[model samples]
Target: MTDEASAPGKSTAPGKSTAPQASDQYVQSLARGLSVIRAFDAANPVMTLSEVAARTDLTRATARRFLHTLVELGYVRTDGKSFVLTAKVLQLGYSYLSALSLPQLAQPHLEDLSLALGESTSAAVLDGTDIFYVARVATRRIMTIGITVGTRFPAYATSMGRVLLAGLPQPRLEEYLAAAELHAITPRTVATRGELLAVLDKVRAQGWCLLDQELEVGLMSIAAPVWNHNAGDVVAAVNVSLQAQSVAAQADPAAYLESVRRHVVETARAISQDVSAKHGDA
Candidate 1:
């Protein structure tokens, strides 16, 4: 994406190249390759040669070359009818998970939380405006949206995003606010920078955030920051997302979220203990 499309909320200032972009300068093949992978997602998983061209906005020939290159790299595959992804793509996400101490330790907690809360639970980190789900436990809900382990979401609207952003340094947080698009996804979406900032403050002060249909209709989530020994710096975030319909039908939203947040904190604490034990940090 042009630095203009540089993920969503985060800005790369003009003439101050924080992220590499192509122009009269130079095109980085590595960046382009990753962008190609990002372009192929749950929605656009299978694309024809022409569809890939339109989706990536690359010329048909350019798209074909990259597609073939990805095929050679074993990251993408074709079924003759259309192009699709392969399990080998998991290596990219697993590379990070394998190196991380938290995800490996907290995975069981996530599963337990999902079972207890009757909702999907995820551990994520802020990546630009998006939070990248590292470890997730899928749950069965009538309105459950299937977000795989490597899903990304807009921070300005997601429970995890706001919780994680609340942990960012002031300057970085300002940078994010200055560039956020704040697109409207639902009637309760926080599209203005002021609202986002206020919510971030409340998230920091309250130590958790409740996102009620901000990212999508019929979806509600509660997120809390995951910290290490310090309890100040947030290393990651954990969230429980449940169907909004279930919230109104079953239990009180505030009490439900409070219970879920407590479980998330306990899980994080347990994971931190495991990490410290493994790494001799204990």
Candidate 2:
């Protein structure tokens, strides 16, 4: 199953540029090469030459050349018939993750929160229309898909995504609302711009978000923002997710969830303080 909350659609070939056709800076070949690499995913980790060509919307000759180039570069491997990405592919994102201090700083806090709450804790940063997971401490699998450091979910459907959205400046937030393709991941997802704007206003004022089964049928999550003191803006979000049944079983479900929200907010604040101390607000 796809880790993303949204339903699958046609994969856009990276080579299909959204940039101006006359733009001198565009690199079509690089985009096509990346498209070939992206053609492999959780559901189709190993694919034949024709399969890769069809997925990437590239000619068989072009796909074969890109695949062989990637294989030679150690980013892909083939066993005569099917090709799969190699561990070396992760190196592509290593530099960015290494330079970002949020994951390193948030890991300990997430681990502690997960230990205390007996739930999964995660940290994510807004990446385009999605929240890209940077660190995770899972006590048990609450989602159908196994969540790992690189997993991504629609920002509109997830607690961490809403927290990040709430942190955005008004202009950017409006731009996002106008451009976002709002659709229902679940019945509870806020799929309308007007509803989402109201929710974001509340989340911004309250400095936290509690999303109940919006991203998935049985999952519930609470999130708070992690700030960049120097920029005075949110750089990431931290959250804890548990099965809805667990909260329902509590003697006082509202109070139990409130306590969890408090813990999540405290952890987020602590991480923000640490970030401020290390990066300095001057």
List the global CA lDDT of all models.
0.70, 0.82
Candidate 2 contains a number of clashing pairs equal to 0
Model 2, TM vs. native: 0.89
Candidate 1 local accuracy as lDDT? 0.70
Compose the digit string of candidate 2's lDDT tens values, residues 1-282.
Answer: 222232232123222323235467888788788888777765467899999999878899999999999999999999988999999989989999999888999999998998888878999999767788999887766676677787667688888989999999989888767656787777887888889989999999999999887787878889999998878999999998877888899999999999999999999999999888878833
Clashing pairs in 1: none
lDDT of 1 by residue, 52-117 (tens): 766556687887888889999898998765788788988887777888877777789888888887
Worst 10 residues of 1 by lDDT: 1-10
Query: Lowest-scoring 10 consecutive residues by lDDT in candidate 2?
Result: 2-11
Index of the highest-lDDT prediction = 2
Which candidate achieves the best TM-score against the true structure? 2
Candidate 2 overall lDDT versus native: 0.82
Total clashes, candidate 1? 0
